[model samples]
Target: MPDNFGRYFVNAIVAGLVGRIIGVVKTEYERAKVETAAKLKGIGIGVGLLVAAAAIGFFLLGVLITAAILGLATVWPAWLAALTVGGAMLLIILILAGIGASMIKKNKDLTPQQSIDNIKAALPLVD
Candidate 1:
């Protein structure tokens, strides 16, 4: 009877350990899911910024072309006016693109690396 009790005790301990491991994994998985969602959201914002930059560039260039030509043509040559407006528009685009690129690079990690490391640490045979 003592041997039987000892066997059952060991089994209970192993079972409990397995259950705890499963619980940790489940919790980490959910955390990873939330992190992925946030990363995706950031990516979307970065893309939106890039698209807005292009759209604004084109719209402003088109709208300002006539005004710049009329306003600056009196002071400078028509060609020079157009050139100035084009350069300014290009500069605007570059600045916005740089900001958007930085954002994209920042959120580029879609995988939950920290969670993965935690899970790896918890599982001994997962190496």
Candidate 2:
């Protein structure tokens, strides 16, 4: 009976260690999932707000262009005033689009490179 005591003790220790490890892994996974969901929600809200702001800005711009056309109509023909306003708006749009495209081209990954570097640094330790 005493000879089996050591075997039972080792088995118990191994089981406990595995159980603890599984518990820790499950907790960390749940935490990561919740955090990721929260971050995605925040990003969605931010994008929605930005799109709303852009829509409002465009509406204001349209109003201002109409006002400009009306103001210019007092001096020139209505058609010429409209054409001038449209041409200026087109020029502004082109310039802004070029800048936006260049910025997009220069953009990097959204994920943090530092975190990836840290993970890489830790991987060698595992071996």
60 in model 1: Cα distance from truth in Å?
Answer: 4.0
Q: lDDT score, residue 38, model 1? A: 89
> Of the candidates shown, which would achieve the greatest TM-score relative to the real structure?
1
* lDDT of model 1, residue 82: 68
Q: Give one digit per residue, the lDDT tens place, for model 1 in 57-117.
A: 8876775677676766576566566667677877888888888888899999899987898
lDDT of 2 at 80: 58
Cα displacement (angstroms), candidate 1, residue 23, comes to 1.2
| Model 2 regions lying over 4 Å from their true place | 74-127
Per-candidate TM-score against the hidden true structure: 0.77, 0.56
Q: What are the per-residue Cα lDDT tens digits for candidate 2 across 1-127?
A: 8879989999999999778656655665565566556555555555554455455558557756776867666766665556566666656555555554444443322444444444445444422
